[model samples]
Target chain A: MKTIFTRRFPASVKIIAIVVLSLLLVLSSDSLAPARQYLSTFFSPLQVIASAPLEALDNVSETVKSRETLMAENQKLRQLELSISDRLLKLEHLEQENSRLRAMLGSPVVTTQRKLIARIQSVDTDPFRLQVVLNKGIKDDVFIGQPVVDEHGVVGQVVEVNEFSSRVLLIADNSHAIPLRNQRNDVRLIGLGRGDVHQMELQYVTKNTDVKIGDMLVTSGLGDRFPEGYPVASVTGIENRGNEIYSTIRIRPIAQLDRIRYVLLLWPELATSDASAPEVLSQ
Target chain B: MRRSPFFTFLIIWLSILCAALLQILPLPPLVDEYFRPQWMLLTAMYWALALPNRFGIGSAWIAGLILDVLWGTTLGFNGVMFGLCAAFMVENNHKLRTYSVWHQSLILLGLVLVYQMLFGTLSSWLDDALVTNSYYASSFITLLAWPWIFFTLRKVRRRLFLS
Candidate 1:
């Protein structure tokens, strides 16, 4: 029943100490990257355990899937693959001719992307940040700032790397902004996340800017972080409120941000001396 | 019965882990961060009240640090707030333990308001942490959840052996 404040480890003093320590940790998170790796290594087991139910649900659905639907899907995929392969044959020819032309110009040889498949490990980021944990990490050569993309388009970039898992800040996070160009007219703009999973707003868009509904935006390669020419988002909605200097243009990410399962990690060709580097086929 | 402090240690760590799991459990977006009460803080508050000497500011600080990692908030961010919260609990442990659940809920609401406000503001300033109008939604649910958690945890505490 004694007054707790009078104790040696006084509440006020402890509060100040903790606050200072917490601020220090937050402000210098970059310096604490190694510390975060160790912390996540300890917590990865807990994260793995938490992800078990999700994986189980995935497995159950996979097993309980009706054979008829799967057959239908397989047939659809076969047709799509046939068409894709046909186009791929033409693409290979075009690629060779383009690379040959570039070689004739004495430009640097085209470098093929080294891709590794990774799975989304966790999707429970608080509303404050939009991020997902990838099961691949430092062990998998997931260096920070690596671009992640699904088959459709750009998803996000690696912000924090751990031992066995890394965190990717989604392109839809408010803090995230990507340089993009309109696919139709090649007009350039930056897409900024509005904290929504699918929607991003165009930055620095004047009312007279050449943008319209359904315009596809691709990576402009301005930042050089994300590779050029990847489809990012399409213009979903364009609005001009009265007297507003800038038009409000909403773009939805081409990648399915809501239900992420698997994605490909891109590396600069021969960027790493690891085993996976040499296996990349030149496109 | 004189119970070993190890029992207290076990209870705190076990509950902390459980809270961390629940806090990050992949529920739908709306139900996860908004609907979920401040589990880590609630656990810290309950134990700080039940065992004031054992579960004080230090315990809450550690719980918050873990949550900072788990919640994807700034490191030590939740730690600082939870530590302050634990200080409040330990300082007024006698009064809070004696207060009716209804009254305690009101007090808990005030504490949550502070936590949420500081979280929203600091997270925005510290980094471009997407603070929005919906940030206060979490505080609302945390307020509504206090009475049920207080009673359930009180019952659970009695069942556990503590010195």
Candidate 2:
């Protein structure tokens, strides 16, 4: 009876031993960084393969759209074009006048160069993080720190570069922060990412600051990583608690992350005249 | 009797694909950024609860590693969370086998809470991160999803393992 009990005891011990061994096996994968890198490289091709079907489906749907529907939309757009023409004429005059005024004030002419267009190929598979992968990569001269922007506003900066693709870390990522200044009053503040793709929080603003709910925040050019005068966000709400040293300012990001089709990767030219420009610029 | 291991593997791969799709789908404005549904977690939870003999802690850890790479998070955060959760479920398999739907749900909810706390604490310690209450909001959603996932998986198992 003692021998039989001892044998059964070893059987239970074996079960526990197996469970512990399996647990160690599970935990070991986390420590193997090389395995992850290898898996990403291995899985990237599969991602590209999977996304291709959706892209093709999108193309086919667009192609198969009825011409009658297109004609009506084109006619409506033509009417809109006629109405906006006068505004464009006035806008051109205003732009020239503004440049002239800036020249008179001896402000350096802000010229942007080195624009490379890239299509968004993928989005990060992590729900909590906001990141996008672009088709442009080192092959297209895209670098890790390149600034990606749309016509409307700044989008994000390239965080990782692959052979044929690069990943953009949006301003709403928890790790991203940008130096911003109010476009109206030029008061400087640090726009910290709230980890939400739609919102950023402004920090270090004194209670006496002139920031209002509708104030526009633009890149201050203090951070060399991002260019100056790019629209970052607009203040959506502000509260100056009577006793607090600083006001709490919340901003809504201007970029339409979902609507992005094409983005310009701004690769600064080292040979440019303003390449050595001072980091500090008044908002 | 032989288990259809190949079919099980294929289903896992399909689930991973679905999880990745769920991760990328844009949410509405009211959804908190930190509170997005953890598809990988749900899938891992399902596998561990249903098929401990096949999908064990080792499988969960591998899936978590993929998540870490895709998200660019601190490397092992999701991995450790996933592994621990799977092991917890596996150890309780015999007890879980006899549980009713409601009881299973409560267990899963507790497991989800534990997973979230593990990830949250690790995040705060590593990066001085501050997250809102939205992070835990997914637990309710996951509980609602658990029964559906369980039933669907059971159907799949019957179809695949049928002699």
Candidate 3:
């Protein structure tokens, strides 16, 4: 057997053998996961270098912005801040009252997990898949399956993590589906990506289901991958047809997925998780 | 003067690196879908054809592996595709060398079409992707990129051998 193995085949034949073996290895199991992680770490610098030209262009565009627009933005923000602080006062009071009620009822208080802000470096907007490379990873305690969100709502979960960067499989990928509950009716359904930037469709809803256009959908925390009560998408259209068993419901993602720049990484599993870094940015 | 093989290999990898950069370079929202060429594949194919004895299927397989990581696919998905193309180029090197660059590009158009269909079907089956007819736009765009990449690589290889 050793003598037969040592006998060399032609180069093409050898390459064919190796390629088929490696492809099978990858397809059958995740034994190469560690190797892929290290390779991705080694490749991260190249990824950053590839994205530099776009970054430079963005910088140039940022510098030439008008002062008038900045001032107008600042003026609008001051009013928003004022209104938010007023709401915060009421929220603080309500939180105290709710906690007291919870204590009396012998319930556990909700714990706030530390979060870190990650900047998106590059995006893979393929017809088959949707993904983005974030400029944060294992060193920053970003674990696989970590929930990611933008300022407005849930963006995606961390799918691949390297030493210095990780890849996020966005909710808009055709292969991706998220558990969600309608905010108004509270009916639970799964949202499936239609491989488009702006649309996701609901699954397993009957024709008689109560759904209306403009109804908001939030993550139900059913799978525990996404935190509870964060906005995911809002219903854009709904169609009921007798031929189909399920009504066609479309929802537009709340986060501006097309122009996403920054996202927040959440620490969902607090104590048992290896994400114990203390210097994280609070969400 | 005997040129160091290491330097030539470096030059080859650098060229492929530039191709990888072009692969990820973002464009305008409207044009991006139609314009991204298979830069890495084209560069590897040029070398596999021009220097089959040296580049061979091995380098192309490695290039595909890197692309798999870069494109975030399962490890050997692109490695298989690229390996197949590089092996084909090596086998057809003599017949291909008789043609002009434009003629070679016409051949590339056919290869790109087949590659695209196979890729689409495989991805849809494995990754559950819902693909449409519009993905074909990039194949023609890939054909358009071939001449520029071929000439540039040819010039570089000549410069390396001369010194």
Q: How well is candidate 1 docked (DockQ)?
A: 0.62
Candidate 3 lDDT, tens digit per residue, A84-136? 98997897677567656766777534323677999889644344678888999
Residue-level lDDT tens digits of model 3 in B63-111: 9888888888877767777888887887788899889988999898788
- Which whole-number lDDT from 0 to 100 does residue B41 have in model 3? 88
Better of 1 and 2 by TM-score: 1
For model 3, give the interface RMSD.
Answer: 5.3
Give the candidates in order of DockQ, highest first.
Answer: 1, 3, 2
Over A1-283, each residue of candidate 1 has an lDDT whose tens digit, in order, gives 2334546766778888888888788889888878877887788777788888989999999999999999999999999999998998897676666656766777533233577889888646655888898888888888989999988999999988888888888899989999998999999999999888878999989999999899999998777688777899999898899998999899999999888888888875422212221243221
> In what order do the candidates fall by lDDT, top score first?
3, 1, 2
Better of 2 and 3 by TM-score: 3
DockQ of each: 0.62, 0.24, 0.45
Q: Please, what are the lDDT tens digits per residue for candidate 2 over residues A64-134?
A: 99999899989999998987977878865765666566667776445345677787774444444567877
Q: Of 1 and 3, which scores higher on TM-score?
A: 3
Looking at model 2, how many pairs of residues clash?
Answer: 0
> Judged by TM-score, which candidate is best?
3
Native-to-model Cα distance after best TM-score fit, residue A23 in candidate 1, in Å? 1.9
> Model 2 misses residue A122 by how many Å?
6.4
As a whole number from 0 to 100, the lDDT of residue A40 in candidate 2 is 55
Least accurate 10 contiguous residues by lDDT in model 3 chain B: B1-10
- TM-score of chain B taken alone, candidate 2: 0.87
